[model samples]
Target chain A: MPFTMTAAALKIDHLGKRFGATAAVDDLSLEIAPGEIFGLLGPNGAGKSTTINMITGVTRPQTGSVSVFGYDNRRQALIARRLVGVMHQEIVIDHFFTVRQAIRIHVGYYGLPDDPGWRATLIERLGLGPHLAKPLRELSGGMKRRFMIAKAMIHKPRLLILDEPTAGVDIELRRSLWEFVREINGQGTTVLLTTHYLEEAEKMCGRIAIMNRGRLVALEGKETLLNRLGGRRLIVTLAQPLATLPAALAEDRSLLSWDPDHLTFAVAGPGAVGERLRRLALGGLHIADLDMRKPDLEEVFLQLTGNGNHHPAAEP
Target chain B: MTGPLPLPPFQPWLPFLTLLKREVLRFLRVSFQTLLAPVITASLYLFVFGATLGQRISVLEGFSYAQFVIPGLILMGIINNSFANTSTSLFMSRYLGNIVDLLVAPITAPQLILAYTLAAMLRGMLVGAVITLIALGFAPLPWVYPGLGLVMALLSSFLFAQFGLIAAIHANTFDALSMFTNFLLLPLIYFGGVFYPVSILPPFWEGLSRCNPLFYLIDGFRFALLGSGDNPFWLSFGISAAMAGGLFLWAALLIATGYRLRN
Candidate 1:
């Protein structure tokens, strides 16, 4: 986060876009550090894809600017574009080409040469080697996703933006895909990702930005946000079923759940749990087993978005 | 694949060249529909109108009707295929959502237009060449003003290819695209003096035919191939060149600005 004199790898400055009176991305500004894995999380219609589209020059920003490395995405568009590679949300497979031919041809789209060694490395790395001579459209869904990854990395881009890379994929592909993403980040390629799976973001991202209805709701380091927004929960199981006479404990607003068997409260610090326990004993409540639960990314995401039946991307 | 390779030298035109190659390969992959279909259609016209009908009527001086219609058939093939290639290529890319490949490319607008147009022209000319060979079997035709013939072919192909680019940009559905070919394009080709001499028509129809744009292309090509046409070579060539130049500017503007191609 200390991107002082060194330029940010991807800098979005008050970027805004509107579609027919709807603000798809409203006055959003965020910076990504070089060699960092950044996560953008939101619910459906939260403008994640619009933001990526602006960054990749697929859509122009209405109010603000985007820059990749040191080049403005609009003014120095060709240069800025060369530095960023994108794997679109959709598969977008071309039926006219073989997998090898499409990957080799796509390299030139970024004005890069066809380095056979680098090309082979990418094909093998993405597990696309055996399907090289097959038509691109003939590949199965998982294989097509792998082919897309190879295409996105064919130019050896400095920054890679993946819009929902693991959506609808099986568990094995998702695990290998995340591992490959981490491997690429380790090799100095800055990555910006938006995914539906919150647990994946928790494990992969160093910094996370949460958006809601086209605005930034939270931006912090992974652990900091987890602690600040996803505070710990303390659950206490009662020795006996209580019949509705816990006014003193119920009045505390941090208390989340109470049942015949248990009482739960949201606790910010370790001290809060012990203090609550002493108060419970003083109130003549029988002693019971106590359990502590650490909040995961899913809790924070649910609280921020208020709904999660779908995902957050391609709203614009 | 064990060790990373050093980056290769950058070629500025690599993207343009690759796109051009892709566009050409697209039609060639379906050679039956693109090349053989047009050739077969042209030969049918030759056989029906010229071989069977030629024994009765002669349209031009010292040249049989078969020889006269040959040039027109070739020009029509060049025009239709040129338009078909680019329009289908661009529209299919949009329909399948793969146009994002071109949208994200580092190449410029002119490079994009030239690549598509040139590839379309190659297909158009290939179809024209096959039709020409088929025409040769029907009649002994003189290759009059061969250099002029090539120039006229290039200009006609360039004009139609650009028009196809514009059509693709504006077409929202396959129905809209088919309307262009059925209602507008075929009628113009039919009225443009493809099957018969414009001179044989009534004065009013002949005068109206002069106003049709395809008339100039066919007339100019006829002058080049058979040394006889309704209009002189310079007049037809000049009009075709001017139209191509104007269309180029329009196509270049639309492509550079991503008019209907991007949001």
Candidate 2:
């Protein structure tokens, strides 16, 4: 059982779905490890939701299969669903039900008796205790999102899929939500998240799969993705305004650009930044201050999924 | 870190019970619309049809117009409320995007159909009972065979609830949902011996009335209530029972196929 849990919290093999002439998801395959926070990043119409839908059995796959905790989604849907919990992108809860009542209904869905202690802990953690008696319609967007998270966690599912969990949340609330997610992950729930907020994925996910046009463009650790850009930027603040570029600096025009007050250079390696600084100094260019900018996941995302000739995982 | 928590033994019926409770509560929460309003509507029909028309007409040989219309109105209440309960709930769930609550659960399609259908039946029966009480105020409703009356009522509720479920699945908008209730259901109810006996109709019209399933349900209900109907009690009972079973299977099939409920 332990081995089964570790092998794949979720496994999608050659999954495909089509609506009319359009393919919503095409030959999508992924495996999420137990106890890992996996980020599924994509732009609009990128099939992240489609894949999530198939995993939760909300939508059937036209081809292939999804297995959750060793239960095939189609053949053993009930068991597969038992192992997974999903917080949908929409705030789709019953408006007539109060927060507590809604959560109770969700708890009952998993066949669990209401545990007041656990319910209280979750409510307090989500900062929803004050509004437990408020109807869902009365709650704010962020509060509703918190309620959704709380509902998803009620079942103690082995796999929790959060689709755009922080979409409409404020910055402070997003922080709190992230902390809450980490807390749950710490308690052994494997989180599969999708978000438009790249920074959220960078900070929270151990691994991420970037999809575009119903295909995965990149799947790797956050650090590995960032490192693929292969270099960093050097921003140099000049001591005095430069009317014109020095001949020595002008020689390497491909790597450097300068305005009246600052010079920017794309350095190839860690040692190259220092080498360029020495070169600029030797050329009698004065530097007031210098800062190195590390490449981030956002850059890699734009490059791989952006309008470019480089197609990291383009379909044949 | 400690290992993952072990989940308790999942009792499958718990979800069915929860969904059933939620569906029932959905209507009860708005009792004014789901229960009281229907009773009020049925009362107005009783007033307009029985009070106004009773003095001028007598459709049955032994019964007064009020007695004849009472069973028909009660059965009409059952059919309307049952269909309304399931159709509106399912459609609203889809419209508001809340259907995912059921879709994501570890419940089967059969359980889903049963829960929604049972809840619809309850709402229908509640309204029917209220309307029957109102009808009783006007005239005594004899239960010639209480068992058959109860069975007929249950079967009629079941069949129409399944109809509502099908309509909800097929309807993409509120307009489409109302179209079924208005265009199809209202027409059938009106022509199904709700207002008059099928035996009195022209030969061509009588045969056409037989095609309407509501005719059998209303006739079966009338036979149970007054021991008088245009068709044999056995025929009416058999038709309603067969329809109930067939509609139930169709509902189960649509749910299992994921129909419009899923992608």
Highest DockQ against the true fold, candidate: 2
How does chain B of model 1 score on TM-score? 0.94
Question: lDDT (0-100) at residue A207 of candidate 2?
Answer: 94
Q: Over the stretch B1-263, how does candidate 1's per-residue lDDT look in tens digits? A: 11111222467798899999888878987899999999899889989867898656788888888888888899999999999999999989989988888787788788899999999999999999888888888887788899999999989999999989988888999999988899888988999988777888999999998888888898999999888888888999988898899988888888888887777
State the TM-score for model 1. 0.92
Q: Which of the CAPRI classes, incorrect, acceptable, medium or high, describes model 1?
A: acceptable
lDDT of 1: 0.84
lDDT of 1 by residue, A107-208 (tens): 977777788998988877778889999999899998888888888888888789898888877788788888888887888888999999889899999999
TM-score of each: 0.92, 0.92
Best by TM-score: 2
Give DockQ per model, in order. 0.42, 0.50
Model 2, B170-243: lDDT tens digits are 99999999999999999999999988999999999999999998999999999998999988999998888898
Q: Model 2 residue B251 lDDT?
A: 84
Root-mean-square deviation of candidate 1: 5.3
Candidate 2 segments exceeding 4 Å error: A1-5, A238-264, A278-286, A307-316, B1-7
CA lDDT of B183 in candidate 1? Answer: 89
RMSD to native for every prediction? 5.3, 3.8
